[model samples]
Target: MTPPPAPAAAPDPAPGWLVPGALVLRLMLVAALAVALSGSVAAWLVTRASGQEAMRRMVSQQTDEVEVVARLLASKIEQSQKVLRTVAAGITPGMLESPSSLEWLLQQGLPAVQFFDTMQVARDNGELRLSLRAGQLEKAADLDPTERDALRRTLVDGKPLVSELITGRTGEARVMFTMPLHREDGTVMGVVAGALRLQSQSLLPPSMTLPARDDSQLIVFTRDGTILSHSDPTRVLGQVRDEVGLAPVYTRWQSQAQPVVGRGMTHVQSDHIVSMAGMPLPQWIVARVSQSQALLAPLRGAQREAWWLAVASMALCMLLAVALMGWMAQPLAQLTFKARQLLKTSTRQRPETEMHWPQAGGEVGDLVRVFQGLVQQGSLQQSRKDTVVGQFQAVLDSATVGIVITRHGMLEVVSHQACVMLGYTAQELQGRPSRTVYASDADYAQVGDRVRAEVAAHGAFDGDICFLRKDGTPVWARVQGRGVRPEEVHGGTVWILEDITAAREAQVQKSWGRMHDALTQLYNRAAFDERLGQLMTERSARQRAPALEEEGGEAQGDGVVLFLDLDHFTVVNDIAGHDAGDDVLRHVARLLVSHVRQIGWAARLGGDEFAVVLPGCALARGQAVAEQLRAAVRAWEPSYQGRSFTLGVSIGLVVLDASLQDVPSVLYAADMACYDAKRAGRNRVETRHARDVSVTSSGRMALGPV
Candidate 1:
C-alpha cells in the first residue's frame, strides 16, 4: 500500500544529448571561474607593479631635488670664497698707511658680501679691525696667542679655513672662515676672516619645509659627527649626541658618495630616512620621514573598501556566467542566427548596433547605454568645427603683430596694426605696389632679391629691415615674411612686422657710448685713428698738386698736428661732479670748433684731450693759432653749483712737411711737447717743427714760441 515503490522512473531517450548539455554547462562554469581568477590576478599584479613604479619615481624626484639644493649650497660657498678674496685683495700696504682708505674698504667691501655675519682684518702686528653694520671698531689689543697662532697658520697657507661652531658677542651661534692676505710677492701680510651664523635657517635649503608630522626633522651635521644646523635649532645646536643609529648610515654615504635611503623599522619616531652629502663642505644633510597616525588613518578605510569591492565583483561575474550558460543551453541555433543578423545590420548603419546590448535593467543594459552615448557624441562633433574656426580667427586678429598681405609684389590687404605702424590708411595701402612705400627703387629691388633667396633656401625669411614712413623718415622693424600662392594669401604674400625702432636706437647708442668717452663725446682713440688715415692720404695727394708750384710757394702742402690737453681739469671734475665736467668739455669743444672753422679739422680726442689738423698752414701760422686757443681756454670761467672756476688748456704744435711720412711719430712728439708744457708750468704753448727735431739722450727740446 506504499504506492508500489513509486513506479521506477522510465529509462527515456538516449542520454547522449543530456551528457553533452551537462558537459557544456560544466565547461561554461569552469571558463567563468578561470576568467574571474585571471582578471583578479592581473589586476593585483598591475597594481603592485604600478605602486612599485610610483615609489621609484617618487624616490628619483626626491633625489633630484636634493641634488639641486646641494648645488645651490655649493654656489653660496663659492660666492663666500670670492668675497673673502676680494676683501684680502683690497687690504694693501699703501691702504694701511691711510685710515680713510681702510675705512672706505670696510664700508664698501663689507656691504658687498652677500651672506656674512662679520668681517675682520687682523694685521701681523697684533692689530685687530672689525667692520659691522653699526660702524668700524678697533680691538683694544691683538687677539690671544692661541687665536693669533691659528690665524697665522691660515695666513701662511693662503687658504680659507672653516672654524668650529662658537657663540659670538651677540650671543648668536656662528662659524668662521679665515683667509690669508698676501702681498704681490706672495708674502703673508694679514688675515681676512668672515663669520656666518649657524641658525636653523642659515644652511638649510631655502625651499625646504618641515614635514607636518611633529616627529619629522631635518638634521645637518659636520663630517666628524658634530651637529652644525638643524630644523630644531634649540635642540641640536651646541649639543653633541652619539647619534648611534645614524652613524652607520652616515659612513655608508661617505664611502659611496651618494644618498642612503631606507626605512627605520624599530625607531617609532622615524620610519624612513633619506641622507645626502653637501659638496665643497664636509657636511651630511638628512631628512627623516616618520610614520604618523594621522596620515595612515584614512588609508586603512580605503583598503577595507577596496577588498569588499573586489570580492563582490568576482561573485557577480560568476553569477552572470551561470545565467548565460543556462540560457544558451535552451537554443543554440536561434542565438547564432540572431548574432549574424545583428552583425549585418551594424555593418550598414551604426545606430542599429547601439541597441544590441540588453537594455532591460542589468549590467548589459548599462553597457548598452554607454555605447549609445558614445555614438551620439560622434554625431555632434561636426557641428562645432565652424565655431572653433571663428575662435581661431579672433585670436589671430587680437595679436599685437602687424599683418600685411601682398600678391605679386602688390599690397592686397593690410590689418589695422599695419596701417598704424606704417602711418598709412588701410584703404590707401590696398592695391598699391610695394614701391610706393619703400622710398628708394634700389632698396625695393634689394628686398625682393633677398625674399626670393630666403624662400629658395629656408622657405621663409626672418630679420630686421628699415622701412620709410609716409613723412620720409626711417622706421626700424623686425619683419618675418613667407611666400604663398595667390589663392592661399586671399591675394598676396603675408608679412608680420614689429616696430623695433626704439630698441634699435638704444643698441646703437650703447655701441657708440662704449667707443667714446661720456663727458667729451669726442672721437676717442678708435675714431682718431680712422680720421688720421684719411688726413694723411689727402695731404699726400695735395703735395703732388701743380698749383703749389705755380703759386711759387714751398712746392709742399703744409700740415699741422696739434695736441691740446686741459690743465686743472681734475680739480674741476673733483670740485664739480661729472655733470659739470661734461659741461666744461662741451664749452671747450665749441671754442675749438669756432677757431678751426677756416682751414682745418678739429676733434675732441678723448676726455680733456683735443686735436686739430690744418692743411696749407706754415709752422709760424700754426703756432699763432695754437697760442690763440691757449689764451681762450686760460681766460674762460665756468659757473657750476653756484661757484665760479677758472681753467686753462696747454697746446703742443708740430708742423709736418711732404717729406715726413711718420704720423704716429709726429703725434708722439706733439704729445711729448704737451707733457713738457705741463711740466714747465700751466697756460703755455710749445711748438716743435718736424725737420728741426733730433734724437738725443736728454730729450731737451729747442722751443720756438711761448
Candidate 2:
C-alpha cells in the first residue's frame, strides 16, 4: 500500500545527493567552495589595493617631475639677475659720465652676458646709458617699460628685482632682471638690467618634460589658469581652461582658491592621473597629466600576475581540502561498512579477519569502537537465543508424552510426543483444529468446556478421556490440562496426555482375579459368602422369583447351601506328606463342581471344605445333590508323586429361606449339619431345613469383614 503524503507544514527532506554519497565527498565539496570564495574575495582586495598604490606612486612621481621643471625655470631667472648684478658692479661714476668709456666697459662685460638676450646700463631717468645686444654694444633710444620698472624698483628698494612677462624693445615676450648700481656711500648711481627672451627653449631645461611620444603632458600654468609653459609650444600662453587634459585640473585648482603651495594627485578628469606643484613668485603651477591606463600599466600587469597566483593558490587549497577530507572520512566509511555487513551475515561469530577497523583516536574512532562493542553484544545475544530455542526443542522431544497447546480451539503447537500419540506430524498438527484428535465432536467440546470451566476455577484439570488414533481406534488417555489465560473466553489450553488403555484392561483382569481362587478357579470363601448374603437379603425382602425355565418346567424353589467336609483327608496328608492332601482337595473340588456345574456354582470355603449354592433348589433336591457329591468324593482314589491314597467327603445341605436372617445364619446351619454327618458316619449326606432348629449346635464360624 502506498503511504499518505506528508503534511505541507512538515519540513522538506534533504537533497537527493545527501543520502547516498560518501561523507568525504560532501565535506570536500564544501571545503572547495569555501576556498574558492575566500580566494576570490582576497584577490579582489589585493588587486584593488595594488591599483591604488600604483596610482599613488604615479601621482607622486608626476608631482616631483613637475616640481623639478618649475625649479629649473626659477634657476634661469636667478642666473639672469646674477648677470645684471655683475654688470652693475663693473660700472663706476666716472665710466658712466662718458658714453664712449661706458661702451668700452660694456663691450668688455658683454663677453660674460652670453646667457642673456641683452644687457644694458640704464640712467636714473630710465634712458639706456649703454647696451649690449647679440654680443655688441649699442644704445637704444626707448627702453621697455618692464625693464624701466625693474630699474626703478631696484633703485627704490636697493635690491635686484625681476619683472613679469613684457614686450621688450625687440617686440618679443621677455622678463628683465635689474640690480641697483650703488655708489661708495650707498647712494644709487643707476641700475643695470638683463632681459631674457621667452619665445624659445632657452628658459626650459633640456629634459624638462616626459617623453612626448606618450600621452602624458607637462604644463607650467599660472594659478589664474593661464599656461606659461607646455609641451606644445603653440599651447603655451593659452588659457588652461581651454586644454582638454588641463581643463578639469584648472577648474579644480580654481575651486581650491588657486592656492600655489600644495602638490597631490586628484581625479579632476576620468582616465587621467594629474600631479601639480606650485612655482615661486609667479604663482605658476607645474602640472602633469597622464592617461591612467598608461600611468598604471606596470601595476596592472603585477595585478594580473597576482590574480593568476591567487587562482593557482585556490586550486591548490581545494585539492588539499579534498585530500584532508578524504583522509578524515576514511574511518567513518569503515564503520559504516562494518555496520551494514552485520545485517547480511547470519552467524553471530564471524571470523576475526572479516572486518578491519580504523584505530584512530578521535570521535570517529570512538564511534567505531562503540559499533564493534554493539556487534559483539549482538553476537552474544544471538548465541544465547539459539541456545534457548534449542533447549526448548529438546525439552519437547524428551517429554515422552503428548504435549499439545491449543489456542482458541486450534492446535498452535504440537510437540514430538504429541505427534507420535496422534500419529501425525507436527507440521500436520499445526494450524489444524484440536478436535481432530478427539474420538468425537462431543468429546472435543467436552474437553474444551471442562478446560475453560475447571481451569478458571482451579487452574488445572485431569481425567481419563478417549482419544482417536490415526487408525480411528479409541486410545484411552489420562489427560491433564491447564489454561494459559483461562479468564479469556477463547484462551490457549495446554494438554498432557498419557495412554491408559492397557492400564484399564490390566485393572479389569486384577478385579477378576481377586474374586476367584487360584488353585481351583472357583469362587473364594469371601465371594461365596457375599453371594449367600445377597440371596438371604432377597428372601428377607420377601421378593418372589420368576419361574425357572427347566426341562420339567417345575416351579423354582428357594436357594440351598451345601457344605462338605473332605473325610480322611488327614490320612492322605499323613501318608503322602500333604502333597497328596492337596491333590485330594483339588480332586474333590472338581468332583463337587462337576456335579453341580449344571444347576449351581461351587466354592472352596477353606482347607478340606467346600460349598455349593443352588439359587432355586428345594431341600429334597439339595439333599439329593449332597448325596451325589458324597458318592463322588467317596469314589475318589488320590495319588501323590506315584504313591496311592483314598479320600472320602461328608456332606450337609441347608435350605436358604426367609427364616435365615443373614449369610452367617445360613452358613452356621449348613456347617452344623455337615458336622452331624461327619459325626454320624463318614461319607454320609445330611439334610437340614431353615426351620430345623434341632440341627444347630456348632462352634461359631463368623464371616469375614464382608
Candidate 3:
C-alpha cells in the first residue's frame, strides 16, 4: 500500500559488488608473473652466454689435442730419420771399398724394430754396393727407373729425401728415406737409404692409424696430397681426395698452397670437423676427421643446464606469487562472502561479530614502480655483460704461461705474463703486429702463412717457436694458439706461450740417456740387442729368401761374437774396493771401443763380463780381436791408493754365421768358449765355430762342425 516502499529501495542495489579480493588476486598474480619472467630470462641469458664460452674453450682444447697427436706422430717419424742418420754417419770411405764390409756395417747399425724392411748403401754412380734385409746381408735388387731418378736427385740435392710411396710386389705400400752420405767437404758421395713399411708400428703408431670411431679417420699425406698412411690399409698410398669427409678440406688446403709447418681445421660440412697439421721434418701433413657431435657434446649439456635453471627459477617465482596472493586477499575474500550472504536474504542486518578489510601491502606494486625496477635490472645486465667481457680478456692472468689475443697480425689483448715475456710494456705492445716479436722474417712469414689459415680451419695451432725479446735475446717458446671463433678466425685468436728451451735440451739429453749406459757411455744391453738382433734377423730372413738360394749366395755368416771375462776383476774389487774395479772396467771399455772403432758395437753384458759384436769378421779375425783384447787387459797396470794391481782377461771368440739358429745360441756358444779359455789358462783366447761344439773336462773343443 505504501507503493511497496519504493520497491524496498532495491536494497540499494548492493553497490554492484566491487569484488576487491579478486582484483588483489589478479594484481598479485601479474606482479608474480612479471618477476618470474624477468628473473628467468636474466638467468637464461647469463647461463647461455657462459655455455657459449665453454663451448669455445672445449672446441679449442679438442683442436689442441689433435695437434698433440700430430706432434707425437711426427716424433715417431723422426725416430726413423735418426736411425737412418746413424747409418749414414757411421759409413767410412774405407768400409765402402769392400762391399761385404759395408753390408756387414749396415746390418750392425740397422734398427731391430720392424720399421725398415730393407736398408742399403749405394755409390754416387748408382751402383748398389750393400743391401741388408731382416738382419742379414744380401745382394741388392735392381733399381727401377723411378728409384734411380730419386737417387740422382738425392745426390744432387745433397739432402735427405723422403720418396713418394711405392707399392711392392707383395702389394705392400712403403716409402724410402734417402740420407746423403757426406764427406768432410760435404760432398754427397753416396746415399744411405732405409725402406719404410708404412704400416710399421715404429714408423706410424697404432693409435694414429686406428681410429676408435667408424665415422672418423686419420691420415698422413705429403705436401702434394699423396696419402702416405691411412687408418684403412686399403687407402694407404691413395689420393687425399678419395675420402668423402676429407675432400673439401684437401681442396681448400691445396688452394691455399700447402704449408710445411702449420695447423688447420675445416667444417664446411655440418657433420664433420677436420683438423690437420703439417710437419716440418718429413713434409707430411697429418689430418684428423671427426664427427661434429664429438665436439659439440659439451655444448648440449651446458645448454640443458641453462634451460633447467630458468625453469626452476620460474617455478619458484610462481609459488611465491600464489602465497602472496592468498595472504593479501584473505580478509577481502571473507568480507565479500559475508556481503553476498546478506544479499541473499531480505533482512538488513544484525551487528556482525568480526570485520575484515583487504590489505594492500603484499599486493603488486604500481606500474611505474615495476618499470623503474626493470630499468635498474637492465643497467645491472649491462654491467654483468661488461664484467663477463673483462673476465674473458683476463682469463688465466695469474698463470705462468703467457696468453695473448690477436686480430689479424696485431695484438689486441695480452696477459701480464705475455708482457713480461716479450720484455715490452702493455702500452708498447697493444695494437702492434706480432711480427715485432719474431726472431726472423722467415719465422714471421711462416706464422703468417699458416697460423691464421690454420686457426680459421682447425681452431688451434701449436708448435715450438722462437721469438725475439725487446732486449734482443732470442727466446724459445712452445706456442699454443686457438681462435676466439673457430668458424671465423678473423674474430680473433688467443695464443699461449711457454718457455721450453730448457725442457727441449733436457729432452735431448734424456733421449741420449735412454740408449746409453750411465757408467760406460756405451750402448746399454737393450740397445746392444736392438742392433745385434737386426743383424741376426737380417741373416735369417736372407737365408730364407728363395732369391738368395737361386742367386747361389753363400750361407756363411758375416758377424763374429766375442766373450771376455776379466781374470783378476774380483781381485781389484776386493783389494782396492769397487772404485778400482770401476776404473779398470772403464779402461777396458775404452780399449775395446778403440779396437772395434767404426766396425763393431761394444756392450757391458753385466758385471765383470764384456761382449763384442764384430760384423764382417771371420773365425781367424775374431780370434785375432780376442787376443788383442786379452793382451790389452793384461797390460793394464792400474795403480790404486799407490798400490799397483795386475789385471788379466780370458777371451773367447764365436763366429756368428748363418748356420746359427738365433742370437741366444751364438751368445751361449761364445760363453762356453770363454769358460774353456779360463779353465785352460789365464789371459788366453778360445774360439768356438759352431753351436754343437762344447768344452770337455780338459778344456778342449769337442763336437766339431759336422
TM-score top scorer:
2
lDDT of 3 at 634: 81
Ranking by lDDT: 2, 3, 1
Worst 10 residues of 1 by lDDT: 260-269
Query: Candidate 2 residues 604-635, lDDT tens each?
Result: 87777788999888877887888788777767
Query: How does each model score on lDDT?
Result: 0.64, 0.73, 0.73
Pairing residues by index, what is the TM-score of model 2?
0.43
Model 1: residues >4 Å from true position, as ranges? 1-36, 97-104, 107-110, 113-115, 124-150, 167-171, 200-216, 238-248, 251-270, 282-305, 324-706
Candidate 1 global TM-score: 0.37
Regions of candidate 3 where Cα sits further than 4 Å from its true position: 1-29, 39-47, 50-54, 108-115, 135-141, 168-170, 207-211, 262-269, 294-313, 325-706
- What 10-residue stretch in candidate 3 is worst by lDDT? 361-370
Candidate 2 segments exceeding 4 Å error: 1-24, 135-142, 167-171, 199-202, 205-207, 258-269, 305-309, 337-706
Query: What is the C-alpha lDDT profile of model 3 across 1-706, one tens digit per residue?
Result: 3333222323234343344554676777788888777877787787778756764664576567667767886787678788778778888877777876776666654453235777777887778777656656755564444555667788888888877666756566667778898888877789887787677777664566654667677788877778877778767778988777788888887898866675745353577767777777667788777776666677778778877877887888788877766776666655555444444443433332222322333222223232343566666798899999778756657778998889877998888888888799888998998888987777798767677676556667887887889999877788898778777848888889998877777776877777776777777766776778888887777667868666865544477988878887888888899988888888888999999965687987777777899986777777777788888888879999889988888887888765566556666788888888999987888887774664333444322211
What overall lDDT, based on C-alpha atoms, would model 2 receive against the true structure? 0.73
lDDT of 1 by residue, 1-706 (tens): 4333333333333322222243455678797888688768865775567545654554555456556655665566666677777777668876655657777777765455445655666675536654443344545342334344546668667667766555545556556667787778877777877666665344444235454335444555655556654555554653334443355555654576653232111112233435343554534353333234333445546555665777788788888877777666645433333433443334223455433545344223333454575767664674487678567556546769888778777887677777788898878888999887786887888888888788677777888888888878888898898766633533357789999999999898877865554555655665555667677777776667768667865654466888888999988889999889888989998788788866676766666878887877777788888899898888899988899998998888877765455556566677777877888896788876656565343454422211
Against the true structure, what is each candidate's TM-score? 0.37, 0.43, 0.41
